[model samples]
Target: MNKKYNIMLLLLLIIISPISYTYNNDFIIRTSVDMKYAFCDVKTNGVSGANNRSSVSRGGIGFGSTSTNSMILMENGENTITIELASLNWFSQDDIPQKERNIFHPNARCEIVVNKMDDQGNIIPLTQLMVKINEDGQPEAYENNKIDSSIEKKIILASNTEKIESDKILERVNAKEYPKDMTVFQFNKKINISDLPKWPWVEADKYEDTPKQRELLQAAYLELWTAFEQQDDSKIKQLLTPSLEVWAASTGGNVEEQFASREIGESFSKQNFQMIPINWNNFQPLIMNNGKMVKLVYKEDFDFSPVSYRFTTEKGTSRVAYHSPIFSFVNGKFIPVI
Candidate 1:
């Protein structure tokens, strides 16, 4: 066999081999509000698992659907792996609050099947390794069996690994191969507001920003940054209106901060500005221009624009000054009006 074939064959055997493991729901599903995606991380064995390991495989559970499709295969032989739900981030239509993105609710159970695959794609399950987290990045394990106040407190205070060891994994077995043709066991539980973290951004719901508004902001935020990074003037123009485009071109400002510029396109091309997505939670809503428009003031951490050739010359500068970009809500979309 050729080198390519040999490599492929080796991988298939190592990941496809089937092995049975005791099903244990030792971990709780934790939701991260800070992430741009609806992300769930796995923690077990006193170790917080990462979602991008080679041993972890991921797939989605559709509504009324009996089987799930496996999209990724992780490294073999590891006892734990984390599966990130890339597809389950807040849907534009789902209307989930932007601040509550980290909260797991009963409205929909985002089921992710993590398969431990051997070289040949055979499988073993490590459900006990699956734990859900609250907004605090802490695990919320199931405590249905015990009602003691102290036990509850202990369970609450117990380390992620400790809480897992004492828990039992309820098996939801199907004859079909999991990930390839797995059965839907259960959806994630809806966490109470009192159970979530006390983050300041969690209160963003008090404002008039609707879920659609936030979703638009998310799309616009990503689009704006991508355009800025690629220096795609046409896309930037498309994202903003004629009035706003002129303003952006004439006035300099980073999405995170504000400043002055003569030509936005020329400034970037000359300085080779690089835009990166760092934080999205550092934003607030404000009414600007005497109620003619609403502005979303994302904190300075949302993205930072810096010169790509800073090493070559100290003269290179970004478009932004000290103030952040103000996205105006116009015609149902956020544009670079400010």
Candidate 2:
């Protein structure tokens, strides 16, 4: 009787063991990209919007946001299971200094990491997307806002950092001689008046430049001049916007190639002499029909030091001041349109 009972118990154990094992193995989990890429639709100010909406140009990830996780219900050939995956952190413009922000600022690569559980609390990566993101402008998800118009009203510099109307500032710039001894940043901070072009809903209201716009311009000015002084073609190109045509009328030549040539030429020339930026004194803002659209004029004087002048060596001397290129402010960036 005891042997018979033991045999029956052993049979029951074998049957239950197989059933449990098959239940656990019925479904498998793996990570993959949601070809639909659905999470990129959240829109906020500070990125992209041509139609009067401002977007912060978040490459793809949220600016200053961290990697995140989510779960998706997936179906395999014969089973369905919930899979956990992570959104890996990508690059963001916020990583760079504010003054150095560019269109390709910060973005994360598109990837999905499938996580599997080993121990109750231990998770391991099992699968992931192998594709890399091509960094460029903001992703298409957030590019919906249409900028109402690109036509900006004329910008006029005020004699002082005082609150003044646009017309008053224009009159001031016309009436007074150029201010001296001001740096580019200082020049940008000075009072300026700007107006919106004639809109149907309202007559253009004249107002002092917004604090944010001033700050943006100052940062752009510093970055641009620094890039020029250092003759960094990559940095300069990153900071400026590309023109619509090979020959941009605003810049008077092929924009990218022109800048590249100038920077490269300076590099070769720098072997013999060093050009130092003294100050960016004069500031004039204009609206143009050419690609530059928005324009600012400033005078820059350089100190020329002879590393190996053709003649006898002499102390560094100040080069005559010249007006800078007509820089355009587009999509919150500064580029030499002229």
Candidate 3:
């Protein structure tokens, strides 16, 4: 009897199997305002010779998003990443210039050092990694390289104030993903200040310039800080959102000043607030938990702008912002809601 020798191939496992990485939020946004609505004043240098390109895209951070002062990822396995949001940087394509030709591309590149931890909380080796989530409910790191990451690995939303420098992967996104006409989350429609509507909190009230209000506050805040170093009442009032009347009345806004002494009146005098109109867009009257009539929606940012207010005395110049803070309007006043 002749028996044939059986040959078998054994596969070896390397690195680790089923590597899981989680994020803190749906998508990572850099805004100059608060946390929840990190949709404005984004830092995007990644756009290819286009002002309309966004900084954050499908695979990674956009061109303008990267910078020397960007955040770094230092992990030891199962760690949480904190990414700050900038001002009203995020907007529909129409708001940005040359958007028709420029596409959305997040030049994603970063190195995540996941340190494994022991039961005692000591740093160990690779156990798992993760990225944060975003407002869109979409997670980073595509499956099957569909979105095209240079490296095929578990991806997640990663946020930081510093630029994430990585050679692990590269990703790309085109105009198809971001439709030009998509309505911005909280910003007013594309229109000049001349077309601004009057303040309208309720449906039957009156339409207003939503973007203008935000811009006015930003500019007025700068003027108040610049003129008196914190004592400019007119600017304080002009910058105050109609809905924020309560907060302004209660805390006496402009008492503390913008961030610190560096943010002063000289920083805002040339802004020409005369042309700025009140921003009144999406905000509407809604009942609060206590049945109190209040506008529940106000959009804020989560990151700082790479390039902020230039403090120019020139007319018809771009207005710089401090941060985006989603506010809740109640009784014709603005109440900042994180």
Candidate 4:
């Protein structure tokens, strides 16, 4: 009987060993940056996360900064990592003086730290990486004034060791997955905005929705939707803020020297917007930024791809999600702020 009991215990250990290791293998990424005005995007193994953006500000308007954390799953092998940092003040060239812009100057610094949690829940630091604009010439880093300063590093993470490309030993770290049998809905067909049903509004304790506010907000949304369906760049521009325009241009590679030259409509077309569908039922009105802006968000978990937007692609399946270009209610009109 004692021999049988010992054999049962050994079988249990064999079944549980792999599960315990897999549960604790994930790495946590903490990113922080200090600058007058800045934005940072960090990615692990081609998956983007830990993104943080500060409000655009001028001299009297004050400074901008960000600090955020994300968790990354690893495969016990070499992993690709990338970081992009941009000075927000550089985009506000018209409002901010050139001397004050300080694009990629020595004063600004961004840092990324990787850590892992043990079975006992204690945080163990693996490694830390820092990027100073002054260090743009580093072998693993590069700078593009038109886009943003970026760094690419490869790391081999295993059960016993963490190794980075530069021979440094240290720590660390979805594109959301779509369903296999998802139905693809074509968005090319035009639908009258008035015929759509009213989407429910998400209640915010701090903000109240009045009839007049609702009317103006709905009107703005309809106008933008109409412009999007018609592919009218001029109309879209009238509704979007100058700051957002600058951001669009910065993200769109070396397309044009000036932001005005990059047509937003053409960019949308290149992204295969026709494959996406406009599902009114999935949208919810969300008041944000101290009630200054109204953003349409997905009611379910607020992801770029909410299951309903999945579509077929050459690579198998993809999701086309819409969330941003949050509208600010100003001067009795709704304008896209970000």
Candidate 5:
């Protein structure tokens, strides 16, 4: 009789206790592109995340120009990853010698590997996709390349972080920026008023030319720059999407902790620096996810935007640091998506 009662209690415990699920909150995208005279960009789940443009222009081998970046898996179901490569018009702005231009036709070889983190923190590759650009600068499948706009996959999350609600997300994304009266300085230089264009100055994928939308986008970028200059991780996190927050938490502690760990701002504060405003001249709108999201791309590189800082070392050498603060338009307001 005692044994029977104990078994019943065990069954009751099993039934009454909540079932725990590991939801994958983050994944890593490894991108490699070899281009003779072209550039490539990688977009996962409609968000442009990584690219190979920076390496290509620096006169590197341009082979094995790779980047590994962590991205948030927003949900536990199907997610789409799309990568596109385009040829560059190297001599579009300037007249070049025919021999220089004839040396290499615009072509690139690109590969992308998507991997998910298991509960044990091991990287398990989900899929591998590759593409090659022909001499004519058109994308062609390479080695089982079934590149499609709807390349979907089901992902199982391994993290227990609770997803924030959409309303709360909207609140965070729409948080007010620091007032103009606030003194924001970078490298001991006060940031002057932003000169970002309010209208579509260059041709792009799409444009929503509305007074309200433009104002919100401008404000979003200003807030982003302000947060970076102040090194306010909490404020910066407030500007990012909840998915990005989850990605930060999954990798380390939280967004603030992750930013603190990098110490990028602290290092910059120690040096003399010059601020490079957003490349307004190259700003172009990229509509993604069937118009559900939008990204302001610069020179076709989605990861190179918003603003940059040029830090000078004691030896008079300098390196420019680019910040990728992505945003999406939701409910008629702009919010940072990454």
Candidate 6:
């Protein structure tokens, strides 16, 4: 019995010792990305129209996130390395600083990101994606609602970290940006605003016109400027379709209802509040014999200019379209409401 016991003890030691050494003295490791990503949609129930239609999410990355169970094992020769990450702590935009959150800016994301620490403590990256999300109760599923646009999730594979052409990995993922340290974690580039023109709605072309009609187009355009500038809903009303009026009413669509609440301004305070001629396009006639149906677009300056051009000379190049049907031709004017 004593002999058997000795043999069994020796066998156990041989088996357990390897594991102990492997975990304690194997290749060293470190994590570079903020490895937490999980989400939930938030909703509100107080609005009636557009206001009633928005939702702000809360507690996105709830509690009880973990990295221990998810850690991957890396085995190379006699060295055994362990890669681990921490759980995510989530909060609304109001909870964290935007600049800090966007530190890497759009390049850095909430997605999975992987980093590898070499045997010499040198860092390298393997994978990364920002955490993407969906907004709950959004009227438009694919629209750019604050709660809908996902920031994209990032994930990095520490065990996969290699020093070879790091650019290869970036190329494969079409990464937005590359990591500073091949051994450390890296970020992808941020999405370009110009690539997606819907937000500012700036790049679409339409219309051409005869020089004679240019003055008429300009005249009508000036009138439009005055109407909107003076917060004259009636003048604005003359410009809209019957159906549009109903839609506007549904949203309380009067100039006062829209701009007055913001206390934007009452009158022209300057001579050059804005330069709008840049916005008019598709200047041909919308319904005329000489290409008469043209469109005259009237909206706020999306080029990041002030709202009131009321005081400006209102000269230069206006977006007057000759013979445009984009707007109805009321008394030789190119109005877009019809």
lDDT values for all models? 0.29, 0.26, 0.26, 0.35, 0.41, 0.26
Top candidate on lDDT is: 5
All candidates: TM-score: 0.28, 0.27, 0.27, 0.34, 0.55, 0.23
- Model 6 agreement with the true structure over 95-167: per-residue lDDT tens digits: 4443333222211123333344445767655433333333321111122333324322234431211222321
Candidate 5, residues 133-190, lDDT tens digits: the string is 5455455544454444433322122111122332111112101111111111101001
* Model 5 / residue 2 / CA error / Å: 80
Q: What is candidate 4's TM-score against the reference?
A: 0.34
Evaluated with TM-score, which candidate comes out highest? 5
Better of 3 and 4 by lDDT: 4
State the lDDT of candidate 3 residue by residue for 142-249, as single tens digits.
323344243223222222121223310112123322333332311111111111122222212121436654453344323423433444545533443332322222
Model 4: per-residue lDDT, tens digit, 290-317? 4644555443323221112222344544
Q: How far is candidate 4 from the true structure (C-alpha RMSD, Å)?
A: 26.3
Supply the global lDDT for candidate 4.
0.35
Pairs that collide, model 4: 126-170, 126-171, 127-171
Arrange candidates by TM-score, descending.
5, 4, 1, 2, 3, 6
TM-score of 2: 0.27
- After superposition, the stretches of candidate 2 with alpha carbons farther than 4 Å from their true spots are 1-208, 244-264, 271-323
Q: Which regions of candidate 3 deviate over 4 angstroms?
A: 1-264, 271-275, 279-323, 329-334
Clash count list over all predictions: 44, 21, 87, 3, 5, 70
Q: Which window of 10 residues has the lowest lDDT sum in candidate 5?
A: 8-17
Write the number of the candidate with greater TM-score, choosing between 1 and 5.
5
> Worst lDDT window (10 residues) for model 6?
9-18
lDDT of 4 at 266: 43
Query: Any residue pairs clashing in model 5, and if so which?
Result: 22-157, 23-157, 23-158, 24-157, 24-158
